[model samples]
Target: MAFTVKINNLSKELTLFLNWLFSIDIQANMPGKSRTFRCKTVKFWSIWPLPPKVEEVHDVVYLDGIYLARNLCVLICCNDTHVLGWYVCRYEHAKALFNVKTMDQAFIWINELSAWRMTYSDFLREMTVDEFENKCFTHERLLKAESSIWRMIRQQTLFTFLEYIDITVPTTNNRIEGGVNAQLRSMLRAHRGLTLERRLKAVY
Candidate 1:
């Protein structure tokens, strides 16, 4: 329901459950990484349930929550960086280590960042250590940032696509409109012998 809308006929409850399950599976599969299962499962819990005083008693109640957050963040960052490294690495053997995420939609974000002067540390600052090490553990925050990055990637891809086609994605197309009008006028003069009704039908 969250990703597909209501088209899938899945309820919000079901969607939330599935999303939680997927996160669990993703964390479970990561290797060479350590995550506190308490944090992992707590990371999947509803954000609204977290009281404002969570910071005071966090150690007492949310040990697993902290681990969950850190694990999810590692995966997200690693997966994203892996995708980026693919397009950048030229070595045939090194290229094998890069994943497909860098070759497709997500690559646009990675490539744009690569060309720009912004450092990975700069991007990490936007996430903030607290956000990265903790906030990324939650489903809601993760999905929000994921969507934001994806949109940036998509916009860059469209701009590149327009450039390749040699057609400016104009803010306004008055020039195109005038060109179409000129074509119709010239065509009409050449076929003035035809009735207006026939001209309209032919144009259509």
Candidate 2:
């Protein structure tokens, strides 16, 4: 067993703030047997003074649309992985949401489960609606422990992306992601301790 040294409230908050800067996932309830999390938590955001998060690097990029991007949420992917799929995110809400432990696992699992999807534009084909439902349900049941959010995603959004891939449609919704966040930070740099609404509005 391990233990954290006793600290005052302010000290603890500062420790967590440091964790978020380096993309370390910490749980108040669990000690460090893990480096990642099974779900999104409040511990991931930056406090003032720290620079914005540095997103994970990928072979390519994507977005979920303007509103989603502006809200500090975006979906990102690459052709080498999904071949036009939505997978990565700014904060990896997908991984945490899906309860997948790491990018390596996510890539393998997504590719294995979704590989049956057709990849050619000239010959568009789809699993029958009945077949799709059955497969999703089967996978969902099999991987239920993996992530409830992932199961929900499989049942709801998987087929939609599959159809788009079959027709060679690009999966990315073009929009500024980290760039938007950077611009907001720069704009707010000179300001000090503004109210939440005012600060956010400036960010927006």
TM-score of each: 0.17, 0.26
Candidate lDDT values, in order: 0.35, 0.40
Model 2: per-residue lDDT, tens digit, 1-204? Answer: 999997555555555434433332334333332243212323423332222343555533443322233444323333333323332223443333244445565556576545423343223222334644552233433244345646755675433333333344433333334454344454445443445544543333
C-alpha lDDT of candidate 1 relative to the true structure: 0.35
Clashes of each: 7, 0
Q: Write the per-residue lDDT of candidate 1 for residues 31-141, one digit (tens) a residue.
A: 323354324344324332221221221111101000112222111001111111111111213132224333464455466545542444344435334634664322445
Clashing pairs in 1: 38-64, 39-64, 39-65, 39-68, 40-68, 69-137, 83-102
Instruction: Name the best candidate (by lDDT).
Output: 2
- Local error of candidate 1 at residue 36 (angstroms): 59
RMSD of 2: 19.0
